[model samples]
Target chain A: AQRVTQPEKLLSVFKGAPVELKCNYSYSGSPELFWYVQYSRQRLQLLLRHISRESIKGFTADLNKGETSFHLKKPFAQEEDSAMYYCALFNDYKLSFGAGTTVTVRA
Target chain B: NAGVTQTPKFRVLKTGQSMTLLCAQDMNHEYMYWYRQDPGMGLRLIHYSVGEGTTAKGEVPDGYNVSRLKKQNFLLGLESAAPSQTSVYFCASSSPGTSKNNEQFFGPGTRLTVL
Candidate 1:
């Protein structure tokens, strides 16, 4: 079975401060990781994927195979960044998601 | 394009009742999925379809049934609703080997409450 864990359920950070959301996965083989964001009551949107190696909305995540982790980070937090974020792992044409972290960026 | 769309933005059901959720995508994606979002558990896949007329069970499929009769549509059915079955259902679609990088496009979600 594949599993994704997001240890922190809630994360609060002040504007302009650096914020990081930790994600860890348990999979025996090479893995594909993705970060998805849900803003307020809106639909979930793709933030970024490990294979893309690109940053979206000033946020970036690096996949660490040694640690089996994919942590999302941003240098400066904006109020607009407040949302629910989920880390997902793809295996056999299916995506397994973490419990998710709710970020609150206070001004 | 509308991307993905789901019917019944919100619903309330009684125990033992039955209902079906409709999902439609305009992106011509080859894969469509149904997932239920619960508090603290994130999103769990209920069922998925890789192509028209092909359906498969996902991680949590015990209480749900799915059909992919058409290429652009997928339907999820709950034969007998239970209190524990209440959740926000989300529909997503993705097409591989495209510029999308297999990114799934999601619907707004359907919030269901069982009484």
Candidate 2:
């Protein structure tokens, strides 16, 4: 079985400040990691995928195979970034998701 | 195109009652999934289908039953509604078996309440 964990339930930061949401996973085989974000009243959407190795909306995540972590980071926070984020792992044909982290970027 | 649409955006059901949630995707993707979202539990897969007429159990499929009679439709049924089953349900689809990365597109979601 595979599991994903998002340690922080809520993370708050001021505008222009850096923010990081921690995620860790436990899988026996190779893993594919992804970050998903859901804004207020909006449907959940993909933020970034580790395979792409590209940043979206100034957010990036590095897959640390050694540590089994894929943490999402943004250099500067914006009020519009406040929303719920989820970390997920794809194994075989199923995707396992973390509990999710809510980010609040205050002005 | 309407990416993925779930019928009955919002529903209220009483305990012991039964209801079925319908999910349709226009992308003609081969893979479809049903998931439930709660406050802190994120999204838990309730059931999934790889192709038409085939259904498989997912992470949380105990109280749920599913059917995939058509290639673009997946239905989730609750035999006896329970308060614990009240949550937001989301339908997602991906063009798997062809795409390597397999990015899933989700629907707006259906909020189900059991009283």
Q: Can you give the lDDT of residue A87 in candidate 2?
A: 97
Candidate 1 chain B, which ten residues in sequence have the lowest lDDT sum? B95-104
Relative to the real complex, the DockQ score for model 1 comes to 0.87
Root-mean-square deviation of candidate 1: 0.7
Tens-place lDDT digits, model 2, residues B1-115: 9999999999999999999999999988999999999998999999999899999999899889999999999999999999999999999988876654578889999999999
Candidate 1's residue-wise lDDT over A9-86, tens digit each? 999999999999999999999999999999998999999999999999999999999999999999999999999999
Q: What share of the true interface contacts does candidate 2 keep?
A: 0.74
lDDT of 2 at B92: 92
Off by over 4 Å in 2: B97-100
Q: Which pairs clash inside model 1?
A: none
Q: Candidate 2 chain B: worst 10 consecutive residues by lDDT?
A: B95-104
Task: Note the residue pairs that clash in candidate 2.
Answer: none
How many residue pairs clash per model?
0, 0
